[model samples]
Target: METKIQKWGNSLAIRIPKSFAKEAKLDYNTEVEMTIEEERLIIKPVKYKKYKLSDLLKEITKHNIHKEIDTGQAQGKELL
Candidate 1:
């Protein structure tokens, strides 16, 4: 498959085919890692580390204190 490098507002860009993108599971706003080697342009999807809420909360200590803000009246099961 061949694609054309077109002008994109003062920058040159290449359009990835929808079929290829779908096969590679690439979607809008997907982060990719691009590199050039031996005159070849390689684009790979960036693998981001997934973290759980519990893992993130463990990183927070007393050094960064997050104060709760009052959001007016309480509703349902909430204790005053």
Candidate 2:
């Protein structure tokens, strides 16, 4: 489980073993957050909340819904 830091272009990189990556649920192109603690580096997945249509609709109510605004007739060529 020991791996050396290799030079990746101008930055140093460490390879995460397949077994560790699989256990951490890390995949190709997966968003991750990296943070450094007192003496350790922490890497975690950046999980985003997926919103549903019904869940979004619930946020719109009479108190917060916008009313239709009446703009005067357009004088320019708007028929097209």
Candidate 3:
């Protein structure tokens, strides 16, 4: 697919064809990551980050097992 960079307000934008957008699952407000490699530029949707509960717990435990509790900071806060 070929696209032309056109002027928009103060930025340059590319008009992607509907067919290409649909095949790539592109939509309004979709978050994308852009990168350049060699002589090519790449654009891809940003994937959600995943975390395993067990792995997170293990990391926290390793770093904070013997940490002192800060009771003063937690005492007067009203959590909404």
The best candidate by TM-score is: 2
For residues 1-80, could you state the per-residue lDDT of candidate 1 as single tens digits? 97789999999998889998998888999999999999998888999899999989998999986888988887866884
Tens digits of per-residue lDDT for model 2, 22-71: 99999888899999999888998998999999999999999999999878
Scored by lDDT, model 3 comes in at: 0.82
* TM-score of structure candidate 2: 0.69
Best-to-worst order by TM-score is: 2, 3, 1
Task: Give lDDT tens digits, candidate 3, residues 8-57.
Answer: 99998889888878888889999999899997878888899799999878
Query: Worst 10-residue stretch by lDDT in candidate 1?
Result: 71-80
Off by over 4 Å in 1: 51-80
TM-scores for the candidates: 0.59, 0.69, 0.67
Ranking by lDDT: 2, 1, 3
State the displacement of the C-alpha of residue 10, model 1, in Å, after optimal TM-score superposition: 1.0
Question: Candidate 3: where is the Cα deviation over 4 Å?
Answer: 61-66, 71-80
Clashing residue pairs in all predictions, respectively, total 0, 0, 0
Name the runs in model 2 displaced over 4 angstroms: 67-80
